[model samples]
Target: MASQRGRLTMGLVLILLAMTALAGRALQLQAIEAPAYASSAASKIQRAYTLHPDRGQIVDRNGTVLAASEPAVLIFADPLMISRNGIDERVSMGPLETQKAAAAPKAIAKILAKHLGGRPEDYRQMVTKTESDGSLARYALVRRHVPSYTYDLIKKDLAAGKWYGISATQDAVRSYPSGTVASNVIGFVNSEGQGGAGLEYALNKQLAGTEGKESYEASTYGRIPLGRATLAPAVNGTYYTLTLDATMQLTTQKALASAVASTGAESGEAIVMNVKTGEVLAMASMPTYDSSNLSAATSNEMVNHAIQDSYEPGSVQKVLTMAALTDQGLVTPDSRVDVPASISSGGGTIKDAFSHGSLALTARGVIAYSSNIGTTLLTRKMDKATFIKYLKSFGLGATTGIGLPGEAKGSVPTASMPDFTRDQISFGQGLSVTAIQEAAAVAGIVNGGVYHSPTIIKSARNGQGEAVKVPVSTSRRVISAKASAEVRNMMEAVVTLEPSRAVAGYRTIGKTGTAQRIDPSCHCYRGYTASYVGIGPAENPSILTYVVLNNPVKGHEGSGVALPVAQQILSVALPRYGVEPSTSKPPKAVLEYQP
Candidate 1:
């Protein structure tokens, strides 16, 4: 009897112990782990979505839109939501309701195809796609970059069914508003809305704003109504204003295309600048592609030739050589120099393009006639080292830092070289330069010897649409005001020679250049590069323009091929840009050698 009582007491204790343990577990679940459990449960029902910011607008100085981003949507779907929202009933009813429910995917696809422009079968496959666990896909991509108006219709139709799965996420689409105008300068963005080339690539940071985020309570298939909603608003990108003028850019491009067609040249580049501020008004390169249709363009057509490629600048080098000499008090425009038809140096013969006998000419006349021998002899006044120093100061051996893509750091002879190197360098050989560098160099003479790094980005607008900053450009004096003024007078002599002038009543000061393009295969002269760089209304000059033609098949000389094109641009551009005509008469020019 006592043993049986002990057994009963043990059973009671065991039962009491099990009950106490159950109570402790319930207390722990309701209190100690309650927050963690609630969080886990909420996470399954809550959706977090990323909000893409709108890319900034790119505009010209006149506020004309060049590139911009438009509001777009990313189409997505909730297959489970479509299945749960009685989509089966909408398709059909009757004894075959189960079979009808199975056909919901096909029926839904047909409706989607009506508005989305896709095959019904294709969308049906998407709607019925299963996950690894055999459940319908909760989320699926339908389309991206759908315009807002289109998504609105889809959203309205889906709303009637209590979130029937068709939905959209936020995105953006890049648009080039100006089409092919300044296309090379204002590059294109890829389908992913990323900048690819030109200023678009260079200044993408200011153009691509930061993304935001959103969190909301959601059902198994879509966002829950009247549920929690929290959002971190997106920060829109900053705006950029360029220095380019749309009118000038369009005009220059036309002139370049006409010049190339007429000259039978492979390609051409032209640049127009505000000399005082180094602002690029118009920069055009031929064989260009439309920014809106980038995929159709060849890589060659995408280059910004004015700033990207460097070529032997030929006689245009004399402009700087003369500038350096005059700055050093080595010669004046009227100082007399001896020039021969040809002179031998560095185991090679240097001569004028046209044969001439020995003659004494003023320094100004040497430039007007473009006598290679005269320039070589003139360089004897200064050593090779001094000449190189002047070239570096002209921004030849380094980048112009024009704040553009693919800017070439052109080649200049280093410390060690032969004596002929000096003669060659003096006349624009043994080196290379971009059209921008040459134009800016010429502008130095017009702007009283101060070389301003060429500028394209006028200002960066903040999110508030106020100008906060600008791209970096350096400006410093390289020659005295007097020296630059004299050089301008000398350049004027070149433009005003004999039966024709570069332009009438403009008092244009400029230089013509013709260089042999070395064949890449054998390093022998195979073609010619004709070019011209000039500034107009010589006194109080405001505009500096440069033109270069590669592989001219018709006229090869700088005078015949390049000068006329430069004249064409300046004649029309100067008058329209409001540059006043020169009131002073043309200077008495010693265009021919004396004695």
Candidate 2:
């Protein structure tokens, strides 16, 4: 009886011990491992995705769109998700099913080719590609930047055919609506949807905007209904309003291209500025490619020549020299000066463009006739320090403060410059200046001596479409108003020299430049650079037009080649901008002094 009781006690002890162990295990699981298991479960079902924001739209001042982005899709494939053998999770299939599974890649390729416009064999290769480890590739890019409607068609085909593993994601594509108009300024977007050049490159951070992300619960088929989801909405890029007139830009481009073609020039560049505001109304560059078709562009064609390139501006430099001399009380427009047929300077003979005897000429006559020796003689009277100070104030030996990528800050001579070099520069040689710099300097000289830094951005809007305040351009006084007026009047004589240069009912003032081209490869003079800069309504100049032609094979003279282009640009720009006609004829100057 005692043995039987001990047996029962042992059985009861064993039962109690088993019960205690079960209770301990339940507590451990509920308290310690519960959070970890829950987290793992959530991780298995949760999916996160990047949300790309729409890129900004670049528009003209008049709301004309230049560049924009459109919605698209990236079609891709998961070869690993597709079954190569007729086995479902290690379960073998029948012979018929196996045969069908083996033929799936070819059949899938056929359906893809029907919509994507590629050979079935190519698609099959993409779908059947393997990794270096001899395993099926996990992911493969089928096509990117596919139109939404086209992808919808592809999706419909995929659903009807019950094709698996192929999928698509959202994307965007940058587009240029105006094609080549202001292309060099607007620049082009690279394949990665990033700005490649010009303003697009300079302001990329502001224009690209910020990306966002979203997390949600998903299943094998699709998103789970009533699933836990969190979204961080994307912020679209800023909307830029450039100070460009699209119509005027197109006009300038066409005129410049025509001039370049007719003159057999290597390339051409032009810039039109609003004198009162210093806004670049139109900037054009020739040998330019279509902004929409960048694949056909050459490296040279992509250059923004107006600001990127610099050259010796020939007689155009005379305007600045004459202005400096007049401002310093060194000479007057009517001051008499004896100009010989030729003068020896630095072991080189200097003469006017046209041969002449030892004729007497007024200071204004030197500019009117573009006499090289006469300009040299006049430059000899001015001190180098004062002349260089005036040039620097006029935006030389420095950038014009025009916000552009790859702008050239042209070189200038210092106070200790050689006399020969000074003589050469007095007539627009021995120094370099860009088209933008020269244009802005001349505008400053005529705009009551105020030098307003040039600007291309007129305004901007934030992602939410709220108007953002754009910083106004910096301005400073460069010369006296009296001196500026004198220079303006002196330039009128240049216009009077050519009857055809006068616009009907509009008084014009300008300077022509024809400097030898400096070859970059050899650093030697190769051909000639023809350029012209002009302002309209001489009494109150409003618009400034500048044109440049590089290495013209047919004609190398600024008057014959570049002046016509400048004239064409001004004729259109003046009328388009509502610039008033001249109120009175300019006072005729005494070009020659009588004995």
Candidate 3:
């Protein structure tokens, strides 16, 4: 009996000890580990990190701000939070709470209508519509971009602090100050901050800054403490300072616009370059777009015609021929040739604009009169190999190396051509080139026979006004200094001699070209490509301008239409650049007749 009672007491003690251990474990879980586990659960419900991006700014060479970033707001909604009361079976609302449920849709509609000032019917319709998932009795907006003013109104009138559904977030947006001026070059951005065209597309990586990350802990009530977050501040993007002078760009654009409008031409392009440096001072193309509103213009209007389009350069190619002849020591300003009415070559005959009866003409006279027959005769004196070499050296049959996108290389005959092909190319036919290539060629002629690669960007800058110079290649002397001068002098005579191509008292040198357009149907001439290229201050020659009119209706000759426009642009542009007018006598015509 004693052994039995001892065993029973020990078993009772073991049971009490086991119960105590169980009770202690329950207290420990409720008191010590609960808060930690709750925190871990909360972390899963809320995302820990958010990214912030630094916006870029754009300024002109003069430091005028063209584009910058402005703070904005985004609005969102949670339908689950708003509709929970209507479908809950475990909890029942009292009379007042039940009354709130019936009126919730109307109340939300009223608030949205009052703040956003839209039709109440639209809001009511949005709230009452059934979602694909029948579980969601209320509507939830996936995302919405709202302006700052509308956000302010929502915060003031809706009392969103007490409501559980509405959410407001902050963001950055791009803003332009100069409106449509230089819009084509400045370009624009999409909502995601991606650049679309022009400088925006060219320097996107530099302009787009690194994104930063943010993390925070939120309470069950969705309130976040200020000190409990980890943040890495974003680094701002670098600023771009272009070489474009806003004033000069505007002036050029206006002139081109006027020319396009008055002449009723389909499109127009104008560019101004500093003769000393290859810095493009001003570049403008008509049918431009507003960077702020890209959709406002058609795709055709957005093209940068000066760099993208190429056509037969017509008489402008004569500048290259003049350079080739003089540089090879085969000709001089006074070198004379017997210019005939026309000459037969290979399988075709080359003709002049007008018949010349075996007239004796100097090398300079041929250029001044722009005779196809005379230029062809001059090319024959020089063999095909030497001609092709000089043409390539002048940057023909190749790209201008301008960094702009969609630039055409401009076509030139690759191999040794037949007599007809050589004759046509000598007179600026059977070849195609861009306006920029023509301008660069002219720069080679007047800028001491050196060719400098053209560029639109001037320099890049930061916020402190400190600048980094853009890399530029040194100018290469493509022809001798003496040859360049001889060509320059002859070109000057074209503008100054008899009935002067340009206006008097301007001291400008130029060449007129009228090339027949190739017709697709008959493979013969149907229209004309008229163009004029000129340089000012005939003695020093500071500015060079090239203008081309494609298929003009009334007068399709360069002298008739293109020369006057070139003269007007140079007249204003020269004085603007501080180039002094020349007081020297105009070039006198040199003439001789043959029977």
For model 2 the local lDDT of residue 85 reads 31
The global Cα lDDT (0 to 1) of model 1 is: 0.83
Please say which candidate is ahead in lDDT: 2 or 3. 2
Judged by whole-model lDDT over C-alpha atoms, candidate 2 comes out at 0.86
Give per-residue CA lDDT, model 2, range 1-595, as digits (tens): 9999999999999999999999889888888888998899788667676677778899999999999988888787767555543133346668876676677787778888998897998898688879999988746878877888988887788777666667777777788889999999999888777899987898787788888888899654557999999998778888899999999999999999999999999889999999988999999999898888988999989999999988898888888898888888888888888999899988988878887799898988888888888889988998888888999988888877667799999889888988888888999988999989998899988888888888899999878899877656778888788888888878899999879988777999998988888898998999999999989979888999999999999989999999999998999989889988888887987799886
Comparing candidate 1 with candidate 3, which one achieves the higher lDDT? 1
Q: For model 3, how does the per-residue alpha-carbon lDDT over 65-161 read when each residue is reduced to its tens digit?
A: 7777777655555454444323343477788767665666667667777766776665765555456766543235423446677777776665642
TM for candidate 1 is: 0.91
Candidates ranked, most accurate by TM-score first: 2, 1, 3
Each model's lDDT: 0.83, 0.86, 0.73
Pairs of residues at least 3 apart in sequence or in different chains that clash in candidate 3: none
List model 1 lDDT by residue over 1-595, tens digit each: 9999999999999999999999899889999999999999787677777788888888999999999888889887667656654443235445555564555566667766767897888787676667889988767777778888888876665555334567677888888878778999999887776789988888787788788899999764346898889999887888988999988888889888898899888889999898888999899998788988877999878988888888898999899999999999998998888787788998889988888888798889889888888889998788778878888888887888888888998888865667898889889888888899888888976788988989998988766677767766689898899999989989888877743756666778889999988778998888899998878888887888899999889989888878877888888778877888888877788755546
- The TM-score of candidate 2 is 0.91
Model 2 is weakest, by summed lDDT over 10 consecutive residues, at: 81-90
Quote the positional error of residue 170 for candidate 2 in Å.
3.6
The stretch of ten residues in a row with the least summed lDDT in candidate 1 is 84-93
